[model samples]
Target: MKAVEYRLPKEFDKSFIVFTERGTYFPCPWHYHPEYEFVLVNRSTGRRMVGDHIGYFDEGDLVFMGPALPHVWVNDAAYVQGQAKEEASAVVVHFVEDFLGKNFLSLPELEPLKKVLDLSKRGLVITGKTKKEINRRINGMIGESGLRRLSSLFTIFDILTHSSEYQPLASPSYMQHTQGYYSDRFSKITDYILRNFQHEISLNEVASEANMATTTFCNFFKEHYRMTFVEYLNTIRIGHVCKLLADSDENVVNIAYECGFNNLANFNRQFKRLKGMSPSEYRKTLELQSA
Candidate 1:
């Protein structure tokens, strides 16, 4: 289900927020970007669901997200309960895909960059030593507006284009959803799964909650979501595990059991099925990344 949030772009201008975030460091919920987004997490320790890409992100991480890809940054529950206020600082620049189109990079010049953006459709997260330098450049131009902001957008992209440490977080075939398309019923399903993903969920049980029969509910869900109930549920569960693996010191076996999978073997199989890497390996990658 889609536990999405909506914030319409009020202006039809050629640009938008060329910064990371605003107001307090609150949750953005699961959503998509209509514009190409470049974000650098200066200080963060939560798991992020970016497009189809799911993983744990910490300090010094840069993610390049393509237009309309669904993603969310779920703060560890403890943080939300006023546990840790230090978890803040992220830089995000949102611009139309063709903001400088037909001008800056010709199709031939864009070949390599296009590949980078294509890889980003599923979502790409970069954590490396270059983090400090990029942060430096971004900080140098924090309040930059007008023409300078546009220039900074290109500069941020330039840094990403030349960086070698980034990795694709989601699969290539992942498509994004618009805010208008996500409904309240979808939110209920999402909330239920997040709270109850640790147990077996039957179609009848969920359908009853949605106030529909088993078969009708199945079609209703798939028609709007494009993924079967189980597919969506597993994605949510997998996304959670990716977070637990990175930030928590919990053992893999315990994490699997906690996220609602029946057995360690099944968890490993499914984790690999959705993430293309085993839990331990994914954790190790984060360790090396955050080191």
Candidate 2:
């Protein structure tokens, strides 16, 4: 999908931005910006889209995204409907690569940090111990200013440079295609799917949304997503099912149907295919972790 370019609020005297976002629900749509983003979700459960990658996110979710990498975190429907127990909140930091100076990262001592910045182009899923440590640093940046704030930002880079508990989202193919294609029609299609994935969606419906013939849309989708439209939609649905399994007491069959799966067997197969475990087993793992 084509990402809308969003301008970060300017703070001319400050080199970067660090703030806590709290609200009934996050208001940003699918968008991207020039500044790299460091996000730690302090309280929320929802779906996250970074480039073409679709996944579920819960409290403690952390990600690093480079400049112009499309992304958004949409709070689950409960949050939007004012039914969630906790308000959605996060610690967000934004800064450009040359925020210090164009020559700053070029320095010999900063080369490792510069390399990590480059890797952020595909977006980084900061996980394991690194995720916790980075969250601590990001939380510390709140209400901090002057040299202390800058130090916290640099400390995050230092930790990321030394940590391997991170994975790249957005496939390499999708990242390559993003350099050339930013279609509004694609954006319309993705926005439509995200809003309606809880119900059945058809090939013709999405193709028509793109204003393309089914054959043409298939080729176009493959070129951009490197997967069939159905593959992408199933991935999104399964991601939502994972969230429900972990966060609620919904029955597996009901969760599958609510997530747009009409067939229980197919839902089980797709869930296992995408998550490497059956839905019940996945929930068991989550319970064990909590216990």
Candidate 3:
């Protein structure tokens, strides 16, 4: 997506920011920034998009992203409609590579940290005990100041570099594509898909939106997304299905139709291809985890 670039609220006295974001909902649009970000979703449930990857996010969701990786956490319908019982909230930390000093990470002793930061180019979602410790330290940093706050950040990095409890969010193909500048045309196309994916979205329809012939648009999309339009559309539909499966008691057949799948078998096939589990199994897994 064509993400709007954002400037963090500057504080000349501080090298980094550690704060709690609390509100009825997270209001940031799909956006990017030059600073690396560490986010701990303390209270919320939503769809999170990082680069070309789409996944559901909930309370205790922790992700760290490299600079300029486009992302947004879109609250579920209940939060957007102000019907959610608990307000959205998160603990977020943002810092540039040189927040300590340009030469600091170049040090041999910091090689592991540098490696982790490179891996973060695709965004990393923390899990297991590592996530628990990082969340606690991030919350603690809210009250720290001066060198102490900075120290806490390094400590968090140390944990990340040494731990295996994380997974990359964006695909390598997507990351390779992001290295190039984004086109406004692709932005418009993705926006249209996101808005209208609940209905049948024809290749010709999106090609028209991009002001290109179907053949031309097909090549353009494949060049940027490394996938055919049908694949990308199915990806989006399946992502929404994941959120619905987790958040509602809706029947699988009905949910598939609502997400624009006309055939139950196709929905099941696509869901398993993308998510590695059947719809019922996916929901059951979440239930087991929560319990």
| Among all candidates shown, the one with the greatest TM-score | 3
Identify the superior model by lDDT, candidate 1 or candidate 2.
2
Candidate 3, residue 256: lDDT: 95
Ordering by lDDT: 3, 2, 1
Candidate 2: residue pairs that collide = none
Worst 10 residues of 2 by lDDT: 173-182
Per-residue CA lDDT of model 3 for 1-291, tens digit only, reads 246899878588998887788999998877889999999999989878776566889999999999988788888879878999999999999999898787978899888787678778879999999999999999999899998988898899889888989987864434433322335776688778878888988889999999999999999899988899999888778767766765688898999999899999999999888766798887775454333
Prediction RMSDs, each to the true structure: 12.8, 11.8, 11.2
The candidate 3 region of ten consecutive residues with least summed lDDT is: 173-182
Measured by lDDT, the strongest candidate is 3
User: lDDT by residue for model 1 over 1-291, one digit each (tens)?
Assistant: 243545546345545655556323545766765677777777656677675455777777677777777677655555656566675768776666666654645667555676567656766776676566667666656677678866765676677678877776753223422221235786566556656777898888899888889999999989976789888777767767776675588998888888788877877888898887888877765554333
For model 3 the TM-score comes to 0.63
- The residue pairs found clashing in candidate 3 are none
Error of 1 at 7 (Å): 4.5
Error at 135, model 2, angstroms = 0.5
TM-score of every prediction relative to native: 0.56, 0.62, 0.63
Model 2 segments more than 4 A misplaced = 177-291
